[model samples]
Target: MTQTARRDVDPSTGEAAPPAFESLDPRTGEVVGRHPIHDEADVAAVVREARQAQTAWAELGFAARKQHLDAWRRMLARRLDEIAGLVCAETGKPLDDAKLELVLVIDHLHWAAANAEKVLKRRKVPAGFLMANQAATVEYLPLGVVGVIGPWNYPVFTPMGSLAYALAAGNAVVFKPSELTPGVGAWLARSFAEAVPDHPVLHVVTGYGETGAALCTSGVDKVAFTGSTATGKRVMASCAQSLTPVLVECGGKDALIVDVDADLPAAAEAAVWGAMSNAGQTCIGVERVYVVDAVADRFLELVTERARKLRPGGEPNAHLGPITMASQVDVIRGHIDDALRGGGRAVVGGEHSVRPPFVEPVVLTDVAADSEAITEETFGPTIVVQRVRDADEGVAQANSSRYGLGGTVFSRSRGLELARRLRSGMVSVNSVISFAAVPALPFGGVGDSGFGRIHGADGLREFTRSQAVTRTRFAMPLNPMSFGRSKGTVRRLVRLVRLMRGR
Candidate 1:
């Protein structure tokens, strides 16, 4: 067979194959890179390799592991531009935004490495009076190997939330990045190899949804997934077969609430950025806006003005790049059409603005609460604004969604108070999506937004299993734990309990 023929056929089956796929640039639809479409066997083998590597990795202990992680962070920081270039080419995000993402990932890596020892160390605990003769302690142990199926948007920052924390917690990682951004995944694996050449502490597996399903069932101790709610459900179902624990960071229809006493300009600027940035591909991106009627018109005016000034392009001055996923453009357009058809008015760009890869910022007003545009996760540069009687009504409307991920509240005096009333996992008062940038804050949501955290102290513990240890400190005067305990001993224990309770 000719070279071309060989390339088109599977060598083992001697038939046409589908074991390879291409990554395309969203800006021009050009092929960026080609990667293997890993299957179940490939995923299983990689996981086995990770399991082998994890033993030596866990043996290295926190001090030694921290050294390797620190080296990796330093390497990533020095080559931030290079990786940012790959992210830009693969995800069609502006280079500046790509750099911003890399900066956050690097900071998380440093935080994970520097704090792992403090967070995961074995600590002593006082034994209860009932077990006064024993010493109690608890320590976190690595879960062996971890499987992380990452998202296409924010591929680096989102997955690294789990990958960095998992590694710092001393578990080996097998990463299956979104097929659209395999090059970014390959870059991370290559850089990690440079940091710790002897062990495959981090491995990359590339493919489509089937490949992700493989990872979920590949017998890894844990799985961390970031994607749509539908896909998260599938991942959870697959992991259930093996009883493997999973951390899911799924979809969100987050809202930005503007109280009557809020800063109109600041809230407007924040709403525009939070909704339109990254082509509104953020899981925590603002999809709906609830403004008190007292400032609804002014808020709408300010936001529309800002939205009109922003553009999506490959230029430096552009506020956003193209929609990273081509299919998302159709979804965005559908939501816009649904809103307009349902009597909503487009204050800025409308359905015609969605042209394939590029979707101009869209601002809609007076959209029905039950409309798809307001109810669903419109992962595009579009947001719906609704007028409410007061902050109470605004909060009520914002909390009427199935998702409870991240949210924002802009109020000069009642920011914190109003934010506390929102049913989201993280809410930024007087800011937009600021919680994601803080490494010490936990990030995750409830309901359809999914569960488990990816940052902060909780994040480190997610990849580990708690192991409690108890040892006899000395002989007890009366041993209740023994079956040989006399009836008199039981009576004495009851009397002691009653006396302690002040009965």
Candidate 2:
């Protein structure tokens, strides 16, 4: 195939020519599989099918929806390995990490299904005495269609946070998986179809950025996007054309804080795993570390040693896999070079060895807080360590970024207090990224990290609309809303207000 043709091939009619997207081993550039996809028109056809399916799916009531979700959950659990391999093949992450992603997704799936009805159920609202004869209630209804634009890293877990919740809340989904890992998305949709066999409630579309843009403008009710902040803005703008709501799970320059009273070994281990796991492709990964002055050198030494042990390669048993997307290698290398040129010293694997796309894990100390490596989201197995005078300084520096997705704090005596002070959606105390496993907690961020949530009760509400209903069962002698109210009624209203206020 021609290089340009090999890059992408859109379908001509409703049927596609063949697989257009190819998964490659970053280390050797060997093709793993060619992911075929239908054309843009076919994508629209899928959305239309989903729209048709949603009418009946939404009417299935919370119990029916939960049953469908539970069936799919069982199927996913039974074939976890098969799905995990697809993730490993496409994103080039270690098999264990891929399995970890699937494990986390199961928790979210279960929570969303079990809690959707309670979170979206209708409840009575108290009306004042004047309207006491009327009944008022509020409920949440599905928004019909939800479009999800997912990222490649942590593909299953990350996007499922939004996808599973949206589904449980009774909305049909049209997911546009990242071009890098289309097969994983396809597999997920196929699995869901097997469980629900009656309709195409969950559909998958594979393409590049253009496909995502088409989804935003393709009349879906909402778009849940997880990618870079720059691209998030564009997605928001495109959605604005139709005033479509979006939940953006964008990039994060998360931080880890170590207090003077922290267990040095435990804190260092958390920092290393937070920054180097999944080759540091996590949106919530710890990109920066702030250690108290008292144990700065000790913590850095321990973390550097641990990071050195996690090397990126294409082998099945490698600790870290090659950079999933080739473009990320350049970004990782650039950040390391910038940090080095800007007065940072590398304590461990800072340079790439002889590998096609595998970049070594990098650990740097004395990096300027204002340097690109410290300030930006490098999305690589690189850590920038800085010494803070105290825990207060660590908190301030951690909240300095525009992004606030995830954070970590390690303190033997003050884990909870410090975890609360960190400005992020969820923080791990003493450990790293454990908040994702606890499906009861909401996951998302404030500011540039985007709004709305994707877990717990908050996530269920994001996919449904609040519906308020009021009905009068009896007549009020002094009807304030009616023009027949007398002067005596106004006086009575004022007296009632004064009595209620205890004035």
On residues 41-128, what C-alpha lDDT tens digit does candidate 2 reach at each position?
Answer: 7677878889999999999999998999999999999999999988888878889889988988987899899999888989988986
Model 1 Cα lDDT, one tens digit per residue, 393-449 = 888988999999999998888888899999999999999999999998899998899
Give residue 366's error in model 1 in angstroms: 0.5
For all predicted structures, in order, the TM-scores are 0.96, 0.95
Q: Flag regions of model 2 displaced more than 4 Å.
A: 1-19, 36-40, 128-130, 352-356
Lowest-sum lDDT 10-residue window in model 2:
1-10
lDDT of all predictions: 0.90, 0.86
Q: What's the residue-level lDDT of 307 in candidate 2?
A: 79
Say which candidate scores most in lDDT.
1
Model 2 clash pairs are 19-36
| Model 1 misplaced regions, further than 4 Å | 1-18
